[model samples]
Target: MIELSRVPDQEMWSISFGGDCANVAIYCARLGLETHFMSATGQDPYSASMRAFLTAEGVCDDLLLVHHDRLPGLYAIQTDASGERTFTYWRDSSAARGFHEVEGSAQALQNASEADVFYLSGITLSLFDRNYRAQIAELARSVRARGGHVAFDGNYRARGWADPAAAREAVASMAGHCSIALPTFDDERALHGDTHEDQAIRRWHDAGVDLVVLKVGAEGAVVSSKDGTAERVPIAQPRDAYDTTGAGDSFNAGFLSAYLAGATALEAAAAGNRLAGEVVMHPGAIIPAEAMPV
Candidate 1:
């Protein structure tokens, strides 16, 4: 999606490439992962610019499909004084919504099944129909069968669903296939009536998720492992955020990067918090590469 972020207290908007999965993929690549982003785009100028941005960020685009008859999705972001953001979307007819119907879609799914980790969010599931969503779950099963991890973040957007029941069913379906679950507490409370982080964790574990990382904004995250271990990992140092746009996405990237590097869940959560701290200090979803901590 093309992101148009309104400059805080200014009458200007800064344009950039940003989407939930795309943000995570770029951050994963930046964290030295061999990341591949699979999605669809149009033959428009904004699409071309997005492609260029992905290439420059070192994110592989081998499975990106192009459709001549469609256009890319777009969204605008506005932030309040506290740096919390609100968004307006214009993506009903985006090329990515036709992903399952694209020419090379079958081959792309085949290739994606061989990945070491398959990461997706609730927003990704919202983009497709029931059949394609079932296909995605099958793909996740195939990846796990091949000894890969399936990570899912239930980044629920109320506007994306036809109703709350539909959202619940869709998110639950994906959660069943995920070995690693990263969910925000607020979203869980809104969607599932999860009164506490423990409720969220219990739900994920009951759904067969092996690792559950429940993100509680500001305070930190709660990590639950399949072995019946649970711990709360707090932010080392919180900052007065400039923008909270990509905090969760960046945290997912950092946590996965560290976990894949053999760090324990607690250690990985610390890394996630550190990276997220840096991200919230910036104005956009992505900060400059040089600004990234070593």
Candidate 2:
């Protein structure tokens, strides 16, 4: 997706590449992970630019398929004084909608099955129909069966689903296959009517997720494991947060980088908070690589 963002009272927008999973892949690559991103894009200039951007970021674009009939999605963002954002999208006919149906997708799936870790978000599930979503779930299951970690983020957007029930069903199905569940408290509240963070944590645990990190915005996350232990990891909010975009995506990257290197879950959450803090200090989903924390 091409993102156009404008700050409060601004007339001009800054164009950049941004999609939930794409942001994670870029950050993970920058964090020294060998990341591969799989998605469908158009044969347009923006699509070409996106592929270049991914390659430059050290993310493998071998699985990115080009669709001849559709264009990539476009979204515009507007941020308020608090750095919170609102988005308007033009994605009904995006090439990514053809992700599962595209040519070479089978080969891509076979390659993805060999990964050590598989990660996706609710937004990824929403792009496909029931059958395609099942395929995704099967892919996650296969990864887990091979002793790989399956990470999931329920990044729910109400507009992305046909209804609340549909969103709930899809998220629940995907949750069952995830080993590491990274769900935002607010999204859980919206999708599952979870009044408390514990409700969200318990739900994921019930779905057999091994680790659940419930992100609570500035207050940080609640780290829980299947062993029945839970802890609150707190973080200081960045005072100069210019935009809140990609906070969770960057957090995922940082957490995964640490956790995969054998950091404890609590330590990974701190790493996640550190990177997320840095991201909000900048303007877009991705900041300059030099701006990253060492």
Candidate 3:
């Protein structure tokens, strides 16, 4: 969990744990994957509680790197009458920013080597400084070069990037390194400017991505492969969404879970849609465990 605080101008809303990678890790665990979160958090009471929560949720804790001097990151979400959401973040000096900057970097690299798939997002990339960012990217490539799969989500937030060109370059460079692309069409449209889903898939395919799972919001998802094949998979059911938070992450969890278990890409996408539809009907990213499907 990300440990958030919600505040409004009239009443104030403050909430935490809206990070994309953390949400995926949590959902992966709930979906029966042996998941581990690789990120930095403060050694404070709140961070401790956050670790406790993940441990209680059955996620592995050995990979969680704790910083004693810094504090955990925080963000606030503001929702208006039309149900639109905006965010204000206070994470400039958060512990996670210093993740790859650790002294014994070999230890961090060793921890990363154990995961079957290293799932990360554009947000995770944006959190790092230049040198550390390159190191992380190299690590991701090394993971895949060794025959381990890498999954990427282009969870782009324009506000998160200091330089738009840097963001584009980073994303383009890393796109090919991943085995799976869990792309949200909305974000892809915003980043690349009005490209069709086919064009987007082609872009990744040309860059050497083996698979692309293009999420089209309520339209469900489309799967495309490098071998000139494509298919559309609709959401399992029509839904009136309550909140769309964590829908993509949970979808990644469901889809990856099914894929890892040997389901077809289309079948995995259906699982993703089923999970996402159920999530949007409830508030927050992590819904009740009992509500999850088999």
Could you give candidate 2's per-residue lDDT for residues 1-294 as a string of tens digits? Answer: 999987445677888899899999999999989999989999989999989989999999988988888999998876778888678889988999987778899889888988999999999998999998998898899999999999999999999999999999999999889999999999999998889998999999999999999889988889999997889989855456778889999999999999998899999999999999999888878989999998
What TM-score does prediction 3 earn?
0.92
Regions of model 3 farther than 4 Å from truth: 1-16, 80-84, 103-105
lDDT of 1 by residue, 1-294 (tens): 999987766899889989999999999999999999999999999999999999899999998999888999999887787888888999999999988778999999999999999999999999988888999999999998899999999999999999989999998888878899999999999998887788889899999999999899999899999777789999999888888999999999999999999999999999999999999988879989988877
Please give the distance, in angstroms, between residue 212's alpha carbon in candidate 3 and its true position after superposition.
0.3
Number of the candidate with higher TM-score, 1 or 3: 1
Candidate 3 achieves a global lDDT of: 0.80
Tell me, by lDDT, which candidate is best.
1
Task: Please name the candidate that would achieve the greatest TM-score relative to the true structure.
Answer: 1
In order of TM-score, best first, we have: 1, 2, 3
For residue 94, give model 2's deviation from the true position in Å.
Answer: 0.6
Q: Report, for every candidate in turn, its global Cα lDDT versus the true structure.
A: 0.92, 0.91, 0.80
RMSD of each: 0.9, 1.2, 2.4
Per-residue lDDT of 197-276 in model 3, one digit per residue for the tens? Answer: 88888888888899999999889999998895889998768787766778899999999989998998999999999998
lDDT of 1: 0.92
